[model samples]
Target: MKSTRDTHRFSATTSRFLLPTFRRPCYLDIIKTNVPKSLNKSNIFHKWTEEGQAPYYTIINDALLSDNYNILNQNMIYINNLREAIKENLHQDSIKVYRNLKFCSTYVKDEYKEGMTFLWPTFSSTSRNKDVASTFGNYTFEINASTNDFTYRTDISMYSKYSYEQEVLFYPYSGFRVKKIIPDARIIQLECVDTIEVESNSRILVPEQVKIFDAERKMFVYFYKDNEDLHWSHADTPDQMYLIGQNMNGYWDSHYRYHHSNGYFVHKGNNLWEEYQNEQFHASFQQI
Candidate 1:
């Protein structure tokens, strides 16, 4: 009679999917609402609040590419490299994409004969003829990898200011839409996308200017100004500072658009870290 005893254990580890009684057009669309209150939009701006000041450029810096599909296809050479960088940094057990900007595969080299120092060349993308159409939303960018420096297309163009008559400068939206996203330092144009519609008051995009270190010139840029401070000298990593209230229209700056009644999205690269200390980082995973 050490007799037999029956025991059973049930596990709830099985993965489950959200099943709905009825599905509607883009039913899963609003599901973004269920994201935990912690990871939700409100607390997402943690980096912003921690910062010293919210300059006019309080908006996050998001660099959108005219063609993000290239990334989905892996044909986007630069982005593929960027994806790898993201995977490496997070030390992620696995990359999990839950929402906008899905996580795609990364490109890795097998040969370890030697290490590689990857560098993205910097180039400027600007508007042509000072109009909104050509330069405002979509940029006709010039990739200058050989030099590793990029400038705004308008910077090279004859006209630098915003003009309506000659250059149909497009200004359309509500509250505010980022009109310009400038890199604080010289960096290679890694990846950009055409349009991403985000309807989250908890989160917003801003113009974050960042600069890197240059040995040749002790100071990265001769002169720099943000909404908060006047000058920056440190060169350890990229410094993200903003000078608020100067935009195409609305509260931001001379480049930001308020809100386009037309619903068609212009190019807005969701806030991101252009380079992770000379490396690259994914947007959602990184901070302001």
Candidate 2:
């Protein structure tokens, strides 16, 4: 729900789709017109919203992935409604989900590397049944996920038109660490992991020049600025106080540090720096 602007201009195609209809109102039309004004103020009517084969989901998901803040703002209302609905119906325990995707051979080879972290920036749909997932494609993703305060996911099968699919929805910007890859079986195992805290009106701030020495690698890791701040840091820390820089792999490797008592910027314990360091140190060893 974090956005820079209040107003948004939709694409021509999306604008046309969102127009009110007088003859027979579609789901979105009803939402734009008939949904009570009081409910809009209260922001409580979203609980009644269903996730069936509505065209709005496509728009919402697309907007979530877009770089344009205006596009996302345009769909903010729908997105908030869906998020509230999902939160209201979230499962109490951990669950496993599956998704199948068809990728170009080159893309799979380049992007699905083992030990890499994959982020779903848009609302993603998965299935509770592995069989249903397999029917979609040959490349299967086996995800272990849970619902918690930081992690947002829900079993939306009850609200979906295709209830038999047993759909599980992961909210936008969910992070998953790739654990294993079985090339023969075309299965990729992933575990849900928390990355960075996302806040509204926040943008990445990078230092002009900063480099860290990797004693293990025997080389210096260079840093570059990013347009957006996706890496997680302490919520209490002011946005301007935190900085993010990408390493050679285009991954966030900058340390989230605070001023120490000794007048040094020291990395915070139990944060992204710890995970990155651990991963880097262990990456050189081959699994026997």
Candidate 3:
């Protein structure tokens, strides 16, 4: 009985400091009996705490509450440090990629006032969202033989420059095909292109002389074979992704295209781009 009375007395003395919120199931139960009957249970205090103040027999000690507060603060600090470390690791990996790869550039020899320069976007595992894949993947190249020779194991494969369409060739694709480009009779010459990827069961009838015109709107992607009256099949439009060519079967009867191999091309052939590209390219940085 004495101990109960003493706890009640302790709460009564601290009544003025405690605010009302005793009605709810809270720590206020600890001092409920000590509260004066005249005090309302729903009042707010001058300050706020995790637990609202309430009158009870045993007042919650401030010292014990402070120990818990210190522990919570330390946990928050630990979480912040962990998050920062993860970001730093990501940044370091990005830097390492830049230092390793040797970067090269490409561009046109002359200036163009009005033309849409197209390029296939390369996949960057870091910069792009990992869940999404890059739709535009394959790209064609002029393959400047002297400077960009694929003879070396590390060199990139040289393809046609007019990479407007995805041409489809026949089964003998393992065999090479002969292709050439010629400038049309005009004041301004047309932009050059190349054949990158060919689909199966399609044949492009090559013409005697490659024709050139102002292909501003990304028109047909065809190749000239020889003096033959027939022209090789070609894609309808540059914007169209799929190129379908027909199988060539005619007088030559060789099945092999022209005097050349089916489609096997040496890097050092034709009026390919030779001038050094003076443009700057960021090979390492991410799109982000």
Q: Pick the candidate with the highest TM-score.
A: 2
lDDT of 3 at 170: 11
TM-score: model 3 vs. ground truth: 0.14
lDDT tens digits, residue span 1-288, model 2: 111211111111221111111111122232343221232312332222233344555566555443234555565565656655655655657888887766555556645667755456556677788876666666788998765535677776665445566767776556676789888788889888653532210114324333343344443322333423222223233232333444212312222321111111223233122122411322121111
Better of 2 and 3 by lDDT: 2
Candidate order, TM-score descending = 2, 1, 3
How far is 276's C-alpha from truth in model 3 (Å)? 19
Candidate 1 regions exceeding 4 Å error are 1-171, 174-211, 220-226, 234-288
Which regions of candidate 3 deviate over 4 angstroms?
1-101, 105-116, 121-222, 225-288
Judge candidate 2 at residue 99 and give its lDDT: 79
True-structure RMSD, every candidate: 26.8, 15.5, 35.4
How much RMSD separates candidate 2 from the native structure?
A: 15.5
In model 2, which residue pairs have backbone atoms overlapping below 3 Å? 196-232
Summed backbone clashes in each candidate are 49, 1, 33
